[model samples]
Target: MIDINFGSLFTVELLHSYYKDQLCPDFNILPSNQTVKTLGGHQIIARQYSNQLITGVNCNGKINPPKPFTAIETGAQFTFFMQLNNPLFFNYTNLSSATPGKIYYFTNRNNNVSNGKTFLSSKIAVYNAANTYAPGDLVSNGTGITYRAIGSSKPGNTFNLTNANHWMVVDKNQYLTEADALKWMPSISAYQFASPQASVNISVLGYDNIATTYTQSVFSKTIAFANPASSFPLDLSFLQSGKYSLTVNGIQQWIYINDELSDSKTFAVIDIFNDASPVSCNLIDGSGALINPAPHYSIYFLNRATIWKYILASKQSGNINDTANLYHFANPASVITSLTPIPLSNKALNLKLTLNNHDYSPIACADPQRLVTITKGTDTYPCSEIFLNF
Candidate 1:
């Protein structure tokens, strides 16, 4: 019989919330070193380098701690609870049908403040003899005209086209009935009519590297408003990694799905000016030609340390009066100084330049190292060997 001893065995207890936006109120207090007994009654010391506590059980009793257990792991082995804070109401003000003078009218008579913009009350109802009307109330006269009430009217007073003191014609388009307007109103707010029954169509199309040729229709979803508002998930897990365009109603935006297989290299020329100069440096490409039109690339300074490749500074192309192909860094040192967790002192760094298309697809350079090593004391450097002074 072979007796293999694996040292002491123990369990670690952790109390934490697995919420996505949960914040740590205070630092956790944990034992830096703990003594435990093995199955054979041999004593062993368990230790933790970090004072912070994480969610995991150290069953192997290894000196190095285990990583934090995730919700996916718990869902597979044990019963897990998930709470979704979904949106239950959609504001009718955001609907394309609610443009000014269309389904509703806005007047400065009763102006209010909302989200730093002038808020005008919407008149979205037809003239009703039984309904009491207030100032700035908009109502349709059942024909092809819309009127705004300048003065309060009692419940029994019917709207008259000749009543200039109480009513003013604002729009002559086809009047929208109260029932039509209620279809787009919010379901939970103070101005809610009934559960909004409006629906919207969303379409997604996949594309190739250039985005000029369409690949295929990726997804099409129709969201029907059953209760003022509802939330639905867009499951694109089945899509192959590539560029895609999403269209909601008529508005479209580009999106990229990265499978971690895309190359991130590009060719760039670096020029470092003298200290205390107005502009610290400029970055261009080979052939001494600027990238042109601006903001098509991003530059980053990364420390060359083995353990931690800390980002010393990062800047995007484009500056006022800088329209050429070259990206000018006005003050490179100020960029490093403004970092949240500043970089370490006296560490040698390298510059990484990445170029992208207008749609943000990586434009890989044919020769990655065409820009050679840039040594110190030289007037200009390539993309390597940079040391910044504090």
Candidate 2:
């Protein structure tokens, strides 16, 4: 007798779908077995048995499809055993931590260059009905409202909102009131540091468009991070809507603050795949705290080396313990874990977790039998015996 593992060729979902649709409905035929060579060069014995086709070469007495079978319900619970060839250690490190970086912002406001900084241009003059207006010329009404000429117009053409052929509104009011300042606060949405620093200086500089060669300091402050694993939200709610240059440490960038529109947040994620057991896993941070809302399992198959590839979904958060992280084959044969929705500034957090061995001690045997049990509703299916080297 030969054991054929369909898992080597197809995903659980694909196999289930094929078994449910393509298999011969007649069950009267006697069982037959034949050796077949796959395109990948692996030879397997295929057998027509019962209503399903079984294919695999027996490695010892283990079952052909070593992985867990498909669950009957979405809430099915899967339990699997795992053994490590070597003693497990706390060697997992966090590589997705946020690092020091800078972001830049720009706007459509008119600017003048002087020295190395850009200043708001003051070349806009009050609208003069007797003067010919050219495209791109800025003009203001007596009430501090600004408009730009979109087309060339003679003295007879008026430059105002009513004159759509010649003018378009730029700034309804160039001067911002206290209420406007309270409403529009610009901010640096996110930034990261390579390492914790004692003190970081942040400066916001403003410039005037009237050929001013000096920098107008708007906001300046120094911040210190008590913990490198934490992120800080820099709020510039006090800043009015305008263009300004922001400097963090020595790095400088331009930013345009629009009312509420400039505020933002950043996020990053890490994915973990458990190839050994179907049980849920935990993600422990550097402080030994289980990451709240731990990594959940979802169907992913891009890394599978088999001929069959299909996507499957786990309960959004996996099982009750939230441990159903997806499984994939890695180069060194290990599970991958993921943590997500992390604040971009807190990328320095160190995270770690252990594979299911109760004791960190090494296993002495090879091809150890690992039992996997999956339960759905009242039905409990014990997976076929799997001989795993690790």
Best by lDDT: 2
* Alpha-carbon RMSD, each predicted model: 30.2, 33.3
- lDDT string for model 2 (76-125, tens) is 11111111121211011111112222121211122222223221222236
Task: Give the TM-score of each candidate.
Answer: 0.19, 0.21
- The local lDDT score (0 to 100) that residue 53 gets in candidate 2 is 32
Location of the lowest summed lDDT over 10 successive residues in candidate 1:
74-83
Best by TM-score: 2
C-alpha-based local distance difference test score of model 2: 0.32
Residue 160 accuracy (lDDT) in model 2 = 55
Candidate 2 — which residues are off by over 4 angstroms?
A: 1-190, 209-214, 260-390
lDDT of 1 by residue, 298-375 (tens): 111111111111122334331111123222232223222111111122321232332222222221111211223222
